[model samples]
Target: MVIEFDAELWLWEARRDDSWTFVSLPVEESEEIREMAGGQRHGFGSVRVRVTVGSSTWTTSIFPDSTRNCYVLPIKRAVRRAEDLEAGDVASMTVELVDI
Candidate 1:
C-alpha cells in the first residue's frame, strides 16, 4: 500500500549526538499499516518501505513506536541533504510498503 502525508522532521532524543532524524506516520495510517503488515514485521517490529521526500527516494524501514502509537521513518543524512531538509521542517512524504 502507498501512503502519503505531511509530517514534521524531528531529531531523535536518544541519538542527538548522531543527529538521527525522523518523521512520524499519522496515527490512522500507522494503524492501517500495522494491520496490513501483520506477520511481516522484521527486527524491532519494523516494516520495510520505499520512501520519497522531494526528489530523494530510498528504501528503508519504519519502526513501530509504542510511545507515539505510530511508525517512525528515519531520514538519512544523504536524503536530507538531497532534499534540503532539517529538523522542525514540515515535509511532504510518500511511503510504500515493500517486500511484504
Candidate 2:
C-alpha cells in the first residue's frame, strides 16, 4: 500500500540532545495501516516502509506513537539534508508498505 501526505517534520522532544526528526502519518491512515498490518507488526509495533521525500528515497520503519495514536516516520539526517528539510518544516511524503 502506498500513502501520501504532507506533514510537519518535528523533533522528538524526549531526546532533546539527539536530532531525531519525524513526520507523523495522518490518524485515519494510521488506523488503516494498523488494521492492515495486523500480526505483521514487528518490534515496537513498527512497520517496514519505503519512503520518499522530494528526491530522496529510503527504506525505514514507522513506529506507533501512543501519544498521537498514529505512526511516525523517522527522517534520517542524510535524507533531510538531501531533501533540504528541517524540524518544523512541512514536507510532502510518500510511504509504501514493504513488509505488509
Among the numbered candidates, top TM-score falls to: 2
The residue ranges of model 2 lying beyond 4 angstroms of the native Cα positions read none
Model 2 worst lDDT window (10 residues): 13-22
Q: What is each predicted model's overall lDDT from 0 to 1?
A: 0.93, 0.93
- Give one clash count per candidate, in the order shown: 0, 0
Off by over 4 Å in 1: none
- lDDT (10s digit) by residue, model 2, range 1-100: 9999999999998887337999999999999999999999999999999999999989999999999999999999998888888898999999999988
lDDT of 1 at 95: 98
Residue-level lDDT of model 1, residues 1-100, one tens digit each, is 8999999999898875536999999999999999998898999999999999998889999999999999999999998888988999999999999977
TM-score per candidate: 0.95, 0.96
TM-score of 2: 0.96
Sequence-dependent TM-score of model 1: 0.95
